[model samples]
Target: MVIINPTISTQPAALTRPAGPAPVLPADRVLNAVVLGERAQHLYELSSGSLRMMAESQTPLREGEQLQLRVLGKDAQQRPQLEILQRGTQDISPQLRNRLPEQLSLNQLSASLNQIRQGENPTLRQLIAPLLSSLPRRQQLSDSAGLQKALHNSGQSLEAKLASGEAPKGDIKAALLKLLATVQAQSPPPPKAGLARSYGPSNTPSPSVHAAGSAPADIATPGTASTAKSASAPQPQAASTAPAYQAPPKPLGLPGELQPQGRLPPSPPEIEGTLLSRLAHDVKGALARQDANQLLGLHSREHGGSYMIELPVRDRDGIDVWQFQFQPPRTERDHSHNERGSQHDTTQTGWTLSLSFDLPGLGAITARVTQQEKQLGIRFDAVQSDALELLRQHTPELHQRLAEKGIDVAGIDCRRRSAQALTESSYSLSALLRDQA
Candidate 1:
């Protein structure tokens, strides 16, 4: 359409009739879109969602090309207007951006759970037990089927799984959600500000409370001592300044108040809620990072069949996480990556597999394997020199196993791990259970 100030902007007006109702996105929501069809006659179809007539873009718009846009509210005809925000899918979602700074870590959560497990509440313990039991054992990841199950339980695609009516099994995110809600339900709420203030500002303790081990029997007059024992006991210290938690009349998703918070509650009920809230924050943070990686796979220059999965396995020293990524081969019509221009390849029915994990003896290791036809090429990057040597020693057996699977081993190499190849446990997730397992 019309290009102004080097940006492609469009006024989405329906050609035949008024523009139809489009999907409602927040005014600041930014997303990516690809040109599916060729541009012709300068006339465009104003779709209800992704509204567009004359689109504003920084880059030249062509078929199969992708550009980013930010929702800018409705236009004169009440049609949505999207201003091109960036040129690629690399721009992370604002919701995710806000979450990154405040998110918690699973390592910390495991420690918190250990402390929380000491509580005497059998009901709370029941909720926590399933989560620990669901963790896969070290031996489970030895087979392909077990590995598949781990990937399925990562809890990234939870909403999609629930929406499809195919319940996800052992989804960690779903477990976190349930555990948080249950803990919140059972938690002993802290003292309310108004109720505490009514006790008066005098130095003597309130008549209703007797030091640390007392409960109010009946309401006493403000600033007046009811008994001799109450007059000698310490008066109510300044009421706790921190805000109190209130149960929503009808809860939606996790509230902002539940985000990973500081200071544990005094009672068992409160402690359970605090620990579970932190755990949920860490798990959901991983989900957000997984979503970002997936968005890149879809809108990046690659052929767009890419995935990242994180699996947490139970080991002798608590939990060890493993990461895996799969990328499908590119096609002839694939868009050029950066300045390389178009790459013409007729035969690319291959795939790439990458996995990173730390073992008892191997330390941190990342393995990348590319499969073309029946042939395979693999490279192992190990952080420790001893680990690299050990991996090299195992290559012969690894090659032998591939051959047994009818795979032609082209080459196998081991090298020191680089920063780029090093993987963290935070950004990997897959399935989300529809209901608690």
Candidate 2:
């Protein structure tokens, strides 16, 4: 009886459960906005209801384009992150609408110039000749010798600037913008009946074809070739009576399972070796000058390309090594032609960075960070059991490291993966290691 009384306690031990982290409530709302300006890395400064916020986009948005954006929470800096749900039906300013086309043309011209400087397009004359010829007529620069001189001088100046390792000055850009705005104010010419054809159909045979046909006669009668040719040549004849042969149109699809069922492969990368070399040189120059904006431009060109950035740091093991590799967001090009005979391409932009190192007693670990517009993601891959346990025990250290590098790690996730994950694009490990050495 005494043993029973001792076994039965007076009060039961209180069962306590550990408290969980606080829940995050999503903030989603719709807002009317207009793009006011564009900055490096495709970030746009937008105006909405007494608020000015920065927004990132995969495609370039023209200034004054009305937008209906879904506000999807704020970033670490408290800037409202936006997701464009729809294009606004509200009318834009008449001046902006009128100048939009001219603005777009000018932007394309500027991009072409940059591509030429980067050596992406080796035949600069072929690309710039049309723009140069049309500029005088379209912008009314034919009579303004000073403006024409400025345009000509700007080309040489740009070359010199590139050679001297100087950032692109905005003077030429400002002049071009002003000229385009003025041109937009003027009335456009009335539509002609049709675009003039570069080559027209003709009944007359080409001189080369005629010579080919008369070659046998000349070879056979070298002594009397002139007289024979004169006698054999036709005199002012009507068009040939025979009709030209035409090939039948090909079928739209294959006979059976061979038919194409999905989207085509993306267009090839636009940035070749020459362009990459030029960009690398420019990036080094910018880095030497500590010009962050200029460095951003080299990586964030209109066309997608791969780049590598390394920062030296001491790891948890107290070993000095490169801590990070930055690959700026890039859009893959999917080119298509519209009914109007104009070419267009689609692009997708997302920023990615990776970190790799080995702990003193543990094995190798790699961390990948990706950000697409407003969303951010983190993944830990190729982790050993011991290292995984160690990382779980000291997870805060990873966050601190990222924060020190100016990366926001508030909403990031940490996980252990048995196998490494494949990226949309390769990480260029060889190139990165070579550069580090």
Please, what are the lDDT tens digits per residue for candidate 1 over residues 123-150?
Answer: 6567678777776778888898987777
Model 2 Cα lDDT, one tens digit per residue, 266-336: 22234333233222222222122222212222323432443332221212222211223456676677777
Clashes of each: 11, 0
Q: Which sections of candidate 2 miss by over 4 Å?
A: 1-303, 311-318, 332-347, 393-437
lDDT of 1 at 226: 47
Q: Give lDDT per model, in order.
A: 0.50, 0.37
The most accurate candidate by lDDT is 1
* Clash tally for model 2: 0
